[model samples]
Target: MTKPIYIHGSGCVSVQPTFEAGYFFDHVTSYTQNPVPALDPDYKAFIPALQLRRMNKSMRMAIFASRMAMQQAGITTVDAIITGSGLGCLRDSERFVEALRTDEGSLLNPTPFIQSTHNMAAAALALSLGCKGYNMTYVNNANSFESALLDAMIYLTEHPAATILLGGVDELGERTTQFWDLANYLKRDDATIPTPLIEQATPGEIATEGATFFVASQEPGDHTFGKIRAVETRLEVDAPEIFISGFLQRNGIEAETLDAVVLGYNGDSRYDEIYRTLGSSLFANLPQIAFKHVVGEYDTVVAAALFLALGIFQRQHVPQRLLLNHSSIPPILRRILIYTQRRGQNHSVILVEK
Candidate 1:
């Protein structure tokens, strides 16, 4: 059996004020625009002004969130660092491409190119924390975060005494956003947060960006938030219900025993049916929660879902705004199953418990 991976701490920076003290999803910040930028936190509190000015949004968010996680875990450093980003340092990437295009033969600034790689966030975290242990980054579209999470679990199983920093970060790119728009991947009409769901759902997703990090270890501590029982991902699942059921059964858990479930309903009419079907059938009687509406949709947004799950475990109360069904809420929250997919692909299931 794999060793229990306990979450000692978590931090998130998203479209909502997730970095704010004492803020859960109780009151969410809404957006009327697509491709929304994450709410910025005061970076000076967590990073040096010189370093902050040199980093892109993704690096800044990643470093800040990781620091928050470290602070909550009461540790200045970790043994390893692992992160996932679907699009890495997007703004810097855009800058490099734009500069290269404009200044063909001239010497160009190399900072953007240096910071534009997908692994730079992990590198930045390692440098900031002085961690020289294992470091890795995954970039598999929507499955990116899950890949990192699964790796963390396996790493803990092999190195039971090791503590690792695991998370995901993604930022919006200007030209890329336009490309997504051209490809009909972004919701043009009615692109608003608190995004309309189910029958009222529209087409495409509300593109946004954010970062979420966690401090994980195999040993449960006095302050440990909860444990991740299992995590699984599929490139494409013909039937999400079957995939989810199999994952739960493998973990020796039944659908009916769950305290609540976090479902990814991003208000995309084309694919929200997947979640709708699961809700009305498998999760009909459970307290179903929706988060993408509040945080908006991004490749690594599911990292925020895991953050929300941990928050729920900590608070023991489900915010009314996140509730998606009329089912009887569990009196004592405990086990929660989070399932999410993007455009009917990259389906993932995460089972978490207190």
Candidate 2:
């Protein structure tokens, strides 16, 4: 068996005001029409002005989050750097598209075009760290982050390196948001007020984006967040419940043993049922939690869910805002499970223990 990979440090910049150490959703904001923007961080501290002037949104976010994770880990170099992103750099992509349309085949600025690639973030992090051992990026839509995570796990098992930096990042674009609204991927009007993600909602889903980065190693650090015991992905399973049960069983854990189950319940009435089935049936007695409503829905949203679980483990307290059940338990957290899917595809199960 492969040695367990431990999460030594984590950093997040999300939509629910998560820069500091308090409960992020003290006063959750609702979006009736517009997409939520990520909470901005002071980039000057980590990035210089000359470099920041040319960095795109994705690059900036990726570098900032990577630096934060490294600082927390108190390390300067890592064995590898990997990232997953749904839309790449939407800001730069949009610029390239607009230039193509307006210029009508004329030469346009290459800055946007250069930064638009999906692997640009990972490359930028490598350049910033000055350590270029191994770098990769995954663009597998909603499963992108999980794909990167699995790669990191494999690297930890095969390589003798001491550390690795892995992350997920996605940014909302104006044109993309507008397109989603037209296709009814976003909320239409005052159809229903925003509530917890698990609540009944409308045809549209909340569109938002952010970044989360973590440092992982085979040996546990002094301030380790948790250990990733196992990760399993199912493309098309006849019975998701059975698949999940088998996963827990293979990992020597029962349904009742999980301290909490982090679910990806976006407000989309169409797909939230998948999560509801698991939350209401299999993990009913455990403390059920969801974060999509606060940060909105995106392909790499599960990264945020992972960060939330880490926060819960560190504080040993469940935030009242994210709770799907009012039931309380002892303040001792030992294990957590995260389940997520998109349109009943790319179903994933992750087990983490402290």
In model 1, where do residues sit more than 4 Å from their true spots?
none
Cα error, candidate 2, residue 145 (Å): 0.5
Best by TM-score: 1
Candidate 1, after superposition: displacement of residue 122 in Å?
0.9
lDDT of 1 at 58: 89
lDDT per residue as tens, model 2, 246-342? 9999988898988888887777788788877877789878888888767777888888888888888888877787888865655798899999887
lDDT of each: 0.92, 0.82
Worst 10 residues of 1 by lDDT: 1-10
TM-score of each: 0.98, 0.94
